[model samples]
Target chain A: MYPWIWRHLPGPLPVRILEAVVLVAGVVALLMFVVFPWAEPKLPFNNVTTPQ
Target chain B: MDPPTEVIAPVDDYDDEYEDYDDEYYEDDDYYDDEDEQPAPPPDSTARKTVRTIGELLITAGLVILLFVVYEVYVTDLISAGKQDDATQALDDQWSSNTVATDPQREVKYDLLDGQAFAKMYIPVFGPDYKFSVVEGTTDKDLEIGPGHYKGTALPGEPGNFSVAGHRVGKGAPFNDLDLLNSCDAIVVETQTQWFVYRVLPMAGEAAGWAEKQANPKCAKVSPLGAPYDKTVGQEIVLPTQGEVISQVPHFTGEVPAAQQAALMTLTTCHPRFSDRQRLIVHAVLTMSYPKAPDFVPEEMKES
Candidate 1:
């Protein structure tokens, strides 16, 4: 899939590889920093209270 | 020619002939292919492999999320509902066996083990069938059984704030409809011998005057009974920090007064349903009391 995406990217081989790397990294960062945090509270797993 | 005699060509002639042959061999793609004789894999196959792997990964992630949803929504409710039944039975047994301690000075004293069933709560505003066993502690294990009373807070029918907490979505969702409770709606707490009726207060700042009234002994006659207070709409909801809403007089700006003449109640649950970002709170003052004998039901419960 990544190679297919890279092939479709509008660049030479080296530039396309770089762009794919950057795109993957951006997606991972978004999931880590923004998406998961926003979604965690909306999920119903962590609200149970134990003595803290 | 010359009868096959040993006739040697010049070395330069031989070298030029060899050089020509080498150039032809180097430029011919077929010559190199014939040497190694292995066909290269198609580029599309590599792309297909990657796509298949990614598809599998996504399916696995989707399954994991589904499992979590099942555990959160269904499994937890099943477990909590079973625990609630057990708690209700235990409370009944305790009541029948006459094991509960009563104090003339304090109304009732609950020296209960953690997670023990102590009382029952009935909210007429939610519906006639809205009742839950009140557990002793607010820990996760205790709350799994039902709504949990905050430790060190006043017990049911006491003069101070008797605070309790329950889950809004999972774990039987005892307080799921707490937001629907309106001003002056009844939240009745039943002990072994008495039933204490508490009425929800009006919005946030409206309690400021009531707090002052509670502090002065002369305002004892200002009871919460009689006609229901007007349901003040569009009041801004207040999300106080932990321990702030459960104070003897909620949001009391003056010195915290002692719990004496007036009894108050605080019910807390997670806000916005299925999210614990903030707390949804309801504060009520005790309006009336009655003995448990002769099948006494409050007027609020009797109302349609």
Candidate 2:
């Protein structure tokens, strides 16, 4: 069972770590750029001509 | 075999019987009786509490409405009371000076020049009584009168545009029939001063030169061009500039005009009376001016 688990593993340890790190960074970026601005009242996001 | 015991018959003494009875039993009975005499709480105490709460709520609501009414009526009056006192004092002074003895026709200053003062308007013919007021920024306040002028304006008697606006339906509805003013109908401003009569000049279609609509033939139409056209040389038109004539809450663009417009009186209101879709504008020219002061000459009074 141990040999089977090792054989079925998708990638090296560094690759897996990079994937996890990228996923968490994307989520944090989405929250900061989209969620926080839309929710907070004090932000002047709507007044700007561009979406940013 | 039983042990032999001496049977001594104890005497039934009254002192021994009294000693056997204890005072604690009587004391406990008396305490229970006292507890029973006290009354239970009434079941309707909650109802009484509820009634008191509702009464308090009603008093609070009444006080809020009373305060609103007081603020609307008496508070507004109190704020304007100082201005009113100043006007009354000025009127009293004007009366004592008998200034009319010199000019015989001095203009009276109208304080608190608001739409509220002009509850209605009258023109004698067409619709004799229409309501109008000195709407803020939209219309001329009491200061704009006659060939004479108020210092507040851009220029004194050299009229570009001197206009006033008012409501049509609400607040006594001055200019209710403003659309009905046609050519040749006499417009009269009845005041402490003489009745200033105005004649409605013919505006051909929507684009007539209304600035040149005064009764005085000497007042000529100066071209829209400035100084190359000398200010002192050309005859003065009494009507205000047509573009400057505005009828809205926040009136006329903040940018003051460079050229001399017409000396004009523009009365306007919301079209269709109540709805604010379109505007009805009536422009008129000063035909005659009068001062309705006491101790005036008979000839001037007849003309007025």
Candidate 3:
């Protein structure tokens, strides 16, 4: 599946690999720094404790 | 041409075969080119398309559930751990600045700011590394910082129940192992100036009788709740309706006939580890307290 994406990417082999790495790192950074923090409060788990 | 005609038969057969091969090659190339241009046709049936849509939706749903779990189990812990460290550092700074007095009689009280650290809690059974900063409120925002001290409850070392609430499965799970506490285990609460050590009490009927005795000193000698003094360790699960678990005397369902004097601590967390269906309550009575000095450490903290 990843190879298919690599083949579709508009670059040579080395450039495609580098692009994939950069893409993956960008996704992880977004999730860790932005998406997760934004979605954390909206999640149901931590808010379970009712205020007394 | 005339010389070839005299020497050999017409090469029409060979030319026809070559033309046929060329036509076949061109047709195959056209087929591939068409595929590249317009892929396979979509399924003709609406039902098939709907099924594909449903499959995509299910995959998306699965991914969302996975991300939610990641957010709950890992991301929240990471964020809360950072918050806990910040709160601990702030508390340490406040202590070092001599903002809190060391007088044993003086009870330091904060203005009940949300997410503000007010105390530090240590459970000896959880080992030396198990310490959490206790913040000022039980709201989600406050608990995300650490275990939150229930506002209006007695402060640590005071003559009433100092109740605290923390998440059992997320937000660093400060009270994740509350159920592991055995009877007589020390749950030490440290304010800026003192360490208040409380011992876990018995569960259920014995706990109720113990509270009754504490509330009414006359009942201490004749209570039927006789689980020997050495065996008060028991576990109890209660629903959210049982708010009295945090009362000055835990399990005392009725109004006390006299003023309560025992300094107690109640740690409450969601029961069944990760579920919020019920509450797990650990009631402990203050056993000893001492003023914080430069080199003083509790014996419980020193043990393995």
Candidate 4:
């Protein structure tokens, strides 16, 4: 699956590497700021207060 | 994948030089391309592709779970520390801007908005840097910024339980080291105009321990409480269902009345570190309170 993604990335090798880095960074940011914050309460071990 | 065959089918040609891609990171994809080497299909080729695909999926799943742990343990602490700093800055601004006051008798204001920080808590045993802003609400969002005071509970230095809640592990875990507190240790709370010093009560599992605690020189400032509140221990692990722990008199289980009550403070966090199965409750009573002067710092804050 990663190979297919690499083959289809719309750039040369260096550009593709940079794009991959940016893409990974974007995903990390999204998870850190948006998705993970939303999903934190649903997961165990985050409930520090009662009725967790 | 089949719908994108027009785009993906051409990748099989690239997969012929799989070493180039394998040198990068697509080592798993080389196995799928291995099947197309012979003109006709091998009997187990399809099974091989299925296994490889499942393996790739499992690897992705493992990476995702690892990322989640990183987010929970480190990233959340970083984020919450920044937020708690912002809250502290806001509190400082709020406290400094109260120069245009009306009644001098009213030192600290009690009417605070949700998530607004009203006081700062210091656990001396945690270190000289051990300080946390005590926010108004105990919601997950509120505690994310700092230790949160339960709504409707007594404010700092009041005649009822000034109960607070904080995280034990992450989200700037203000009470993470709560277990370190012992009998007669001080928990100082600084409001806008006054500093209230509360000490952990004797942990005899009953009210009878206060008389003995008061005899100690270190506990000289730590006052003894009357009937119901004397049962409150310095530290107790109780089920989360015990809302009475934050009541007017902890463990008393009585209706909210305006009668005179003990001036106590309770700090609660999850027990056993990361688990929320039970709550580790630490109760302290207000032993002394004095006006906050510009040059004054609480003595408890200097304890190593």
lDDT of each: 0.69, 0.41, 0.73, 0.81
Ranking by TM-score: 4, 3, 1, 2
Highest-scoring model, TM-score: 4
Off by over 4 Å in 3: A1-9, A12-51, B1-54, B99-111, B205-234, B251-259
| Greater-DockQ candidate between 1 and 2 | 1
Error of 2 at A33 (Å): 49
Best by DockQ: 4
Candidate 3, B249: how far from true, in Å? 3.3
lDDT (10s digit) by residue, model 1, range B198-281: 776655454445656545432243333222222212122444345556665555535545633357788888776766566677
lDDT of 2 by residue, B234-286 (tens): 11122222223332111344443544344444454455543544555555555
Candidate 3 lands at a TM-score of 0.71
DockQ of 3: 0.16
lDDT of 3 by residue, B108-180 (tens): 7564577889789888778889999999988878888999888888888887778888988867988888888
Error of 3 at B114 (Å): 1.9
What TM-score goes with each of the models? 0.63, 0.35, 0.71, 0.81
Clashes of 2: 27
Query: Would you list the rank order by lDDT, best first?
Result: 4, 3, 1, 2
- lDDT at position B240, candidate 2: 26
